[model samples]
Target chain A: MFLLQLRNELRKLFGKKRTYLGFGMFLLAQSAFILVLKYGRGPNQSMMRMMQGNGYAAAHFFSNLTVATTTLLATAYVLLPLYVSLVGGDLVAKEAEDGTLRMILSRPISRLRILLIKWLAGVVFSLILILAFAVFGACFSRLFFPEGGLFVSIPWDGVFGVFEGVEGWQRYAAAHLVLTLKACTIMSLAFMFSCFDIKPAAATIVAISLVFISKIMQDTPYFHDMQGWFFTYHMNVWVYFFAAPIPWWKVGESLSILAGFNLTFFLIGSTAFQIRDFKS
Target chain B: MISLRNVRKNFGGQRAVEDLDLQVPAGEIFGLLGHNGAGKSTAIGMMLGQVWPTAGEIRICGHDIISQRQAALRKVGAIFETPVFYDYLSGWRNLEILSHYSAPTSRHRIGEVVEWVGLTGREHSRVRTYSHGMRTRLALAQALLPQPELLILDEPGDGLDPEGIHEMRLTILRLHREMGLTILLSSHLLNEVQQLCTRIAVMKKGRKVFDGPLSAINKSQSWIRLRVNDFPSAVELLRRERLITDEREGSLIAVAPGSGTEHVVRCLVAQGISVYEIAPQEQTLEDSYLDLMKFDGPAPSGKQQLQPSVLATEH
Candidate 1:
């Protein structure tokens, strides 16, 4: 029964035209980047200079690893949340607004089961989006820049920190894999808001604003001590995979915190949803 | 079988449903009759576990809703107020989604049910394009998909055109008779209730004003109106005996109190007053409904329903 309901929910999510709009936007962005990276001399020259400074001998420094890392960072902050929340935030609130929640609740099943299926479906959609982003980044970037040794400087603390990497394709795949937790966390937050009696757009906007506020606080000097608790701090944890001698402890901490956030958001959502009367 | 015992629901100290107790046996089409704001919606919400009751226990087929809700809800199918659907999805998709939680209603069964509701070709269209009547029929189709033993609907014919209303009535009738499905109908339409329900429970201001078999409730309260000779003497004598409360157009209307209309006639003839004509002033279910709603209001009593008489100028 659970599988049946989850499948139905997946069908409903994918059936919407808006779901494809996100895919199209990401596809265009990735393809455009691929075109510029291959032919644009300014970006290529800058990469060549950075490679020389970082002690790399390769003429082209933008490999599959760098491209995947860049894409994960570039889109995960803004575009990913917007698209993910578009569906996640609408999971329950839209149903309530459409008055279908009352009709659906008329069945023999429990409210918790319905919410579980929806959340699971949202998680699945998030994974698909993350995987698609990875594939697009890898395929498009590799078309322009071959598989070369890669490196990127990180703001580990208050100074410039170079984390040189030559893990080849392994790091690229791991970077994408680690991002699922981040995507799930953001989508779950949006889904938690969706369980409320608010409008779908309002839920999505609030979820994005939460991330925005968290990101700002993470950058604020005074909030350095509190930054670890903010979700955005953990959301950017995928970058750890790009570092040479990958920070497994930091990555595990972020993964655990994200898992906790997902569980908490789900609990809050399901509990709130159970208490709702659908006032329709 | 269904039973609501001492059920009460209040919204912020304002009572929505008050001490509502009801019972509907198997194979009975129980009409929940009330005007708007009569707490019918709130009571139905409680029964469906959508609204939390301030106080009471509701049982369906002997399973209590407070603890054994799923067990109780399994046998029930319901449509509340307007039939709600996913406007973006096709009618087929809507049913397909609904069938997931319902008791394993198969795709083949869905096809049969869609045709059963007379929505064959239009199943591909989104529900946003469905008319009010079509939406209702679709709701019924999904509600019956589980083959539930009990079907509950609130104002099923609301907003339907006359023909649409007639069609909805026929659909409900067929579902009840052919399917032998127990039905609970909530509506302000008295005639619809009269035509459809065998038993009824009337709500007035969060309270059950009346609950019984329909025939019995209507039969107990009706008038026996008579047009007679000598209006002045007729009024004086009937008033003296307190048999008639008021008169109209040279006639005296006796409150039958249910049966024995002949006794009033005999009493009138004993006075040697010539009886010109005699007939029972038919009281419709509407009148009965009105009386239930106005039970506490200062309206004409059974006797006071009689208006002041006019003298027969022909004499």
Candidate 2:
């Protein structure tokens, strides 16, 4: 029964047009980046200068993997969070606003089970969005650039690394796999707000606003020492995958914190959902 | 099949239901009648475990609603006020999704219910394309999917046309008589309640004003309708002789309980009033509902021995 309900939840989530907004937006952003890199200007000047200074041919590193990784970096912070929050914020609040929650709540199932199923559905959606970003970026970039080596640079996180052949592909895949943590954490935050008595749009906006505030605080030099306390700092730990001699301890710590955030958000959402009247 | 013991619900400063005690026995079609804001929906919401009662206990089929909510709700099926569904999904899909919330329902069973509600052909269409009557039918179909012992329908015929209302009434009657499904039907349509429910409870301002069989309301209060040549003279004479307490238009006269219609006719004849037509007028559910709402305080219940001539007309 649980599996059947989860399947139904997935079907319901994917059945709506809004569910594909993230996929569509990511596709457009990735395609535009690929076009600019392939036809307009070859990779960024600073990235080229850094590679040349490191004694590697800058042109040799201008491959599909590089384009895909760079495009993901540019959009993951803004577009990915926006779309994840959009879906997560809608999972419960939209049903309540549409008055379907009253009918569903009238059934024999427990409220806790209903919320768990919905949260699971939101998690699955987050995974799918991240998967699509990886696949689309890789596929679209391959159409415009040749496959060769990979170069990654995120000066903010102080990560600059170069790899070749299988190692480059493995790291690229691992980076996206780790990115799922950020997607799920942001989604869980919006999902927690979705359980409250608020509109879907308001829930999404509030979740995004909090993320923006956290990012701003983490990025500010004055608060650099305090970055470890911000959720955005942990969320950006996915970028650590590109660092040479990757900081395994920092990665583990951030993963633990992200998992805790997910659990805490779900518990709070379940509590709010259980006590709500669902008058609609 | 259902029971409420001193149940009450308050929405902040306002009370939706105040100390409501009700019992619906097995195999009985019970109507919950109330005007807008009388807490019929709130009471039903509590019964279905959607709204938490501020105080007291509610049980369904011998299970406590708060503690054994899943068990209690398992035996019940409900169509709450304004049936809502996923407008993007087809009616068939909607039923399939909603049915999974309770027990698993077979496709054949869903098809049977769809046909039962007269929505067979339209089940393939999205709910956004459905008419109000079609949506109501779909709601009924979903409620019937789990083969529940108790069915709770709140204003099921609310926005239906007269024909649709009549059809809904027929469906309710069939479910009660053939399937032996105990039903709690909340509606403002007194005529529908009169035709369908065996017993009813009327709410006025968050308090249950009346709860009894349909015949009891008629039996508690009755009037004598008369068409006389001298309407004014007959009313004056009846009032002068203390035979009638309330006089209404069309010469309807309210006599005290135990005052038979024949006796009233004899008294009118004795007063030199020619009564062309005289007949006993059994009070309808609507009349009783209006009377109950008119009172500022708690109205009389079935246990009360009411004198219609005095109490019915009193504001």
Q: Whose TM-score is greatest here?
A: 2
TM-score for chain A in each prediction: 0.92, 0.97
The digit string of per-residue lDDT tens for model 2 on B1-315 reads 999999999989899999999999999999999898988989999998998999999999999999999999887889876878998889999999999999778889999999988998899998999988889889988888988899999888877889989988998999988889999999988899998888888898889888888777767666778898898888787777677777676668787545666776788798777889987776777777776676655545676634565454565
Query: Residue A161 lDDT in model 1?
Result: 23
- How much is B14 displaced in model 1, in angstroms? 2.4
In the range B193-262, model 1's lDDT, one tens digit per residue, is 9999988888888888777778766664545567777768876876677666445445535442333546
Error of 2 at B163 (Å): 2.4
Candidate 1 lDDT over residue span A1-280, tens digit each: 7888888899888888887777888878777766665678887677667667767664545666565555556666678878888888999998888788888787877889899999999999988988888888877777766776555555553222233344556666776787888778888999999998899999899998998899898989999999888988988877777666677898889889889999999999999998876555
Q: List where candidate 1 sits over 4 angstroms from the true fold.
A: A34-44, A156-166, B121-129, B224-241, B244-278, B297-315
Question: What DockQ results do all the predictions give, each relative to the true complex?
Answer: 0.53, 0.75
CA lDDT, candidate 2, residue A37: 72
- Residue A113 Cα positional deviation in candidate 1, in Å, after optimal superposition: 0.7
A126-226 per-residue lDDT for model 2 (tens digits): 88888888998898898877888998878878998889989988888899999998999999999999999999999999999999999998989999899
lDDT values of the candidates?
0.78, 0.87
Pick the lDDT winner.
2
- Cα deviation of B161 in candidate 2 (Å)? 1.9
